[model samples]
Each structure stands twice: as structure tokens, then as C-alpha cells.
Target: MTASDPSGPFRLLAQCPPGLEPTLTRELAALGIPAPHQTPMAGGVMWNGGWEQLLRANLHLRVASRVLVEVGSFRARALGELVRKGRVAVDWERIRAAAGGDGRRIVFRVSASRSRLYHEGAIEARLREAGELPDVAGVGEEAEPRTRDPGEAEEFPGVAGPGDRADAPGTPILVVVRVHRDQVTVRLDTSGAHLHQRGYRQHVGTAPMRETLAAGLLLQGPLEPDGGWSRPSLVDPFCGSGTIPIEAVLLARRIPAGMASVGFVPRDFACLHWPDLPPDVWEMEVARARAGIRPLDPERFAVFGSDRDARVIEAARANAKRAGVPEEVHLATAPLSKAPHPDDSGWIVTNPPFGTRLGARKSLRPLYAALGRSVQPGGRMVGWRLLYLSADPVLDHATGLPLEVRMTTRHGGLTVRAVAAR
Candidate 1:
């Protein structure tokens, strides 16, 4: 069935950072997408959904990086057969419109394994020759084969590099082609830029945490109440660019990650440019999401973020302003030794220096110890839950608090774990 079908059985995939599959699955289940319909894989969660589901997945999913809609699948062991079948199996015109309309180009991101058509570049060329794909020179045509990390997401059109831009007019749409065991599956990226972008964090600090991951960490805190909404407070002692506190404010206010507080997505999504999707459908979805936003309850809840660096705190203020929650998140320039402690208990979720990014392991232990002192059993922040990202268990132990590893994931070539004390 077509994607515009109100009750279509659209095969959709929501890709996220590796090791966050379980959290992403729980998010989908909370969205009312049945567990039986979801299949959690290594890098993403696949499910059968309809038009509304597709829109909601892109708009509301806090952990997913991008959403892909499966177009078709076929068996092709040879390049020639692949092209022939792809031409018949896929809808070219719809993809063209989604790319940016008639004259826009297309980029192929091909991954092959255990199949005869192993050359991803060659497969891209064959697809272009079949007239199924628009022309894109030197896009994925690598002369030499190379290994790619499986966790890497597809590159953004204009953000990667100057040469990554399309020679033709308009933004190029990315079409994912995967060949595994002689089966070729084609899917289209519905989310244009990565969801972490959020269009607010134009300015960032060194090794800043992704907004999506920050939101996911907040989800583990004591925020959401039982079948109801509760205004919960949070603090980020190591808030670099204010991602954690900003995301916390977003969650507290029910502001969609894709949307700003005023109810508009700053950067347009690929699905919005589709020729088949009705304009009213997207408008209705945005209205529904905007209607759920609750006013900021400053008296009952508060979010504070502080860093030793003044420049990053300024950047955080700018980002919070762009996110339309400027006054809601209190940002300051201070070290972890002077982190804000509210009179009432709240959550402390942060991404601290992992030694790989900021400071030496030996020098950071004292910082972790100071952090632990602020929230340890009988400390000033007693009854507060603590969660942080740590690359070294030694550093986590330095806190002197009994912390358990909650989740582990790769960040910038380093394996980091989310350690928590509750």
C-alpha cells in the first residue's frame, strides 16, 4: 500500500546509537506501538506502522537518530539483476519528489555483506545506469573498497563536506540500499538531518553530548509520573553546552524534540517534502503535539546547569534561547564543587569529562570525588539520584558511592557506560 494510506502497513525503521536499543524499544512501546509490531536490532528498532505512526516516530522519538521507511525488497545476486529488479520494485517518482522535487539529485548509501554484489560503489553506479536513481557523480563511487563502522549513520547532505553537496539543484535525498545474503532492501531516509540536531544547538562546547542521548538519560530519571504528567527538577553539574538541562526542560514542558516551543520545526524534514503526503496531515500532527505542551512550572520544578567554563555557559544560554526555553533553564559558570543543590530533592544527570576528551584520569578523580560528596547518602543532595557517563570504572569508583552501570555505548571512539547511584 502507498504511504499516504491512512491505515497502511508501512515498514519503518527508527535508527539510534548502538547499545540504546532497549531504551528505544521502551519508547516505542510507550508511544502505543505494540511490542509484537517491534523488532529490536543492533542499531535500530523496526516496526510495522502507518502514516500517523511514521510522523509520530520522527516527531516524538527522543532516542532515534533518524527514521527510514522501507520502499521494497527483492532478490538479486548480480548487479544487472539488482538494477532490473530495483527499477520494478521501487517508486522512483515519489523518491524524486521527496528529494526536493523534479530536478533534485539522489545519493545512494549501499552496504553489502555475504552477497555477490559486495562492491557498494559498483552497486551505486549500476543503479544510476538503470535510470532508477538520479545522477550523482563521485557520491559513493569509491575506487577502493574500505571497511565502514556499522554504527555510523548516513552523512548529511551539506554538513559533511563541500564535495558532499549535490552538483544538481535542490537538496539530495539519501536512499539506503542494503544487500545481505542476495536480498536487496531499499529504504528512504524520512528524517533529513539527524534528530539530535534539534536546530537549537548551533553553538557547542568540546565533546558536547548529543541532545537525543541527553533526553534518553533524562527518561531514566524520576520525571514521568504514573499515567500522568509531573513537573520534575534536574541539574547537570558538568553541563557543557546545556544539553541535559535543555532536554530536561523540553521533556518537562512536553515540547517535541522536532519542534520549538512556538510549535514549528526549525529545519524541515524529508517527509514534509513528499508529493503524496497531504499538507493537512502534517498540520494536524503538529497541532496535536503543540496542544500537549504545558506551561513551565518554575515554582514546583527547576533545571540548573553549570560548568567551569564561562564560554560554554554562554553558549548554553544561546542554545536555550533558541530552544525557546531560555528563562526555564538556569545556566551558570561554576565548577562541580559548587553545583547547585535545590532545597528539595531532584535528579542529577550529566555527561562528565571521560579523560579521553577533557582531562587526565589522575586529575579527574578529585572532581568525581567532589561530585560524589554532593550527593552521597547523607550529603547536601541527599535523596537525589545521580547518573553520569563514564569511560573508566575507576573514575566511577572514585566517587566513593555505590554506582551501577545502567547502559554502555560508544561515543567518539570510546566505550562509555552510564553509571548511576539512586
Candidate 2:
């Protein structure tokens, strides 16, 4: 069935960091979404489901950055063709119905490539013009196209208002138009903000790890409420903003990832705003997701982290407290050599500085070497399975720890490999 079919299933794209597509696919399967399909591109996994599944994904998925609903799509060879197709093919009525009555803040984001319509501006204007075409929501047929000005929303398109942060008060639906070659695919940002904005980490270190990637890394094992195993020791030696450890406790506690983002997407989605739905619509979904939480004893796992910077340790503690995971993590300040280690055997997941700065590359070797020496079998940190991110091959070799490259992924525009030494 098409997206226009009000009750029909539509495709949802769970966007993730590159190289974690398989990880995300597995996460979805574990969430009860069977056999998710990977797209022919980086950073996307496709699954067919209804609004319930869409909401569940936004609520539970830790590996995805955002969830995009395929609202409409069509083949367009020209800007005019895109406008014509966008106006007719887009099930505005469907969205309108979802929002109950009609008339809401609708934002059109468009891009074009290949084909004859290669101009992004013209394509955006065309789609914008189409939306105003009487039947849609905003503009009129004769109204002048808006001047090109991408406001803050466009400036940080990936970041929507987080939790209760009101970035956009009008509840606007973000429409993304991707014209690859000549195929125009239109999608709706079901998630207002990037899922990485997990309502925590208001204060971040210089290089903060994204929550989604942290969750993806956390998925390395079934370190969960579902994995027959109770909690094994989980540690993040380089816990800058405490993302890894925070996400670990979130999983161990079985807390929904989007617990605080309840009002962000569905309520702020313009078309799917709260007032538009039945009183118990979202409440039911929220309850269902919450019910899935299997409360674990707070003492189940020996999870903790440490950093060299005292200030960042304070920030990590505060952030964890705000995330409601403070009790789940033990944060400390120590040098890499003094990084915390499990008493016996434990998992060490961390993202050290990539040394992207000019002169910083020289220090990587010694840093990795020191870390290697610290976690070796004979030390207090002995028998610790270390998971770290590495970019330069020379530095990877310098670690001296027995780590195998299990996967290669991009982080902050750099190709970093996740190396694990068990």
C-alpha cells in the first residue's frame, strides 16, 4: 500500500552512523522488528511498519540518529516536474487527517542531483510553492516563493528541540526531499531532533561521543535486560561525557531511550501533534514501551567510568544524574594510566582522542601504548576486554593490546575502527 493509504504500512528509515548498519539491523530485530532491510546507502536501515512501530522505534532505538517516515516519493526530471509530482503525490490529506483538522507549520527541505533539475534552490522553491497550492497547508498558487533563508532549524537540521527545549514552538513537520540521479524521495522527520540528543549531556567535553553511536557500541554484546546474563562488568576508561557508561545503564535498566523525548516527535510533528490524536493514542504507546522495562536491581552490574579531566568528570556525573542514570554509573577523574579497571574481568569500551589536531598525532602512539600497558594481563586492570576506536593504522598497531578490527565506521567525519582485545 502507498503512503497515502491512511491505515497502510509505510517504510521507516532508521538513520545511523556508517558501518553500524548491521548493528542497527540487529538492534531492530532484537526490538521485535524482524529482518530490517538495509538501504543502498550509508547510515540507513529500512523497515516496513505502522505508526506504532514508528513510535516504538523512536522510543527504543539507541543506534539510530533519527526516524524518517517515507511520506511520499516520485520520479522527477525537472524542477517543475518535482513541484507537480510533489503536489499530487504527497498525501497531504493523509497527514492532515493524522493531525485531525488541518493547517499546521509545514517546512519544505529539498535537494536535487543528476537529471536536469540539479539546482537545489529552484527545487526547494518548487516544492515550497507546491505546498501552498490551495489543497496543501501553507502557500497559495500565486503567492511569491519565500526568500532563501535557512533559519536555525535549517542551520542545525539534525538537532530538533530536545525534550522540553522549544526550538520550534509551532510544531512544524520537516520534509526532506532527496533527488538522487532523478528519483525524488520525500520523507518526513518523524523524529523532531536527532535521537542522539538523548535529553542529557547538556554539558559536553571537547569531543563528545554521540549517544546513538554509544548505544551501537554498547550493543557489542547482549549487555541488556534481555540477555540471559545478568550484568557483567562494563567500564569506559575514556569516558569523556560518560556516554558509553550512561547508555550501558540505560540498557541495563531497560529504560526507553526516548523517555524524555515523548513530546518531541509525535507531539511536535505538526501532523501528528498530541491534540490531533485520540486522548489515549500516544499514552498507550508510551505505556506499552514502559511496560517492556524489566526492572533490574540497581546493583546488577559493576558499571563505571573515568577521565583525566576533573571538570569533565564533574560534567559526566551531572549529566548522568540528569539522565536519571547517575546511580547506574560511578564516575571518577584519573589519567589514562590511572583509568579505572574492573576487579577481575570486565569490558572496557572507550573512544580516545583521535588526534585530529595538527601536532596531536605524535602523542597518540604513547597514549595508546600507555593504555595498552595499563590493561595488560598482569596489571590491576588485567583480563579486561578493551574496546577502543582507532583511525591511523600506525597508532592502532602502537596500542600493543591484542585488539582485532571487528568493524570500521565513520565518527565525526573520520574513519574509525572499533578494535576489541579480549
Q: What does candidate 2's lDDT look like per residue over 102-196, in tens digits?
A: 44455566655576777655676777676552234333212223332221112223234555432344444556677887888878777776677
Using lDDT as the measure, the top candidate is 1
lDDT per residue (tens digit) for residues 222-295 in model 1: 45411122325678988989998998888777787888533444346777667677677678777887787787
Worst 10 residues of 2 by lDDT: 148-157
TM-score of 1: 0.89
Candidate 1 residue pairs in clash (backbone atoms < 3 Å): none
Taking all chains together, the TM-score of candidate 2 against the true structure is 0.83
Instruction: State the lDDT at 297 in candidate 1.
Output: 74
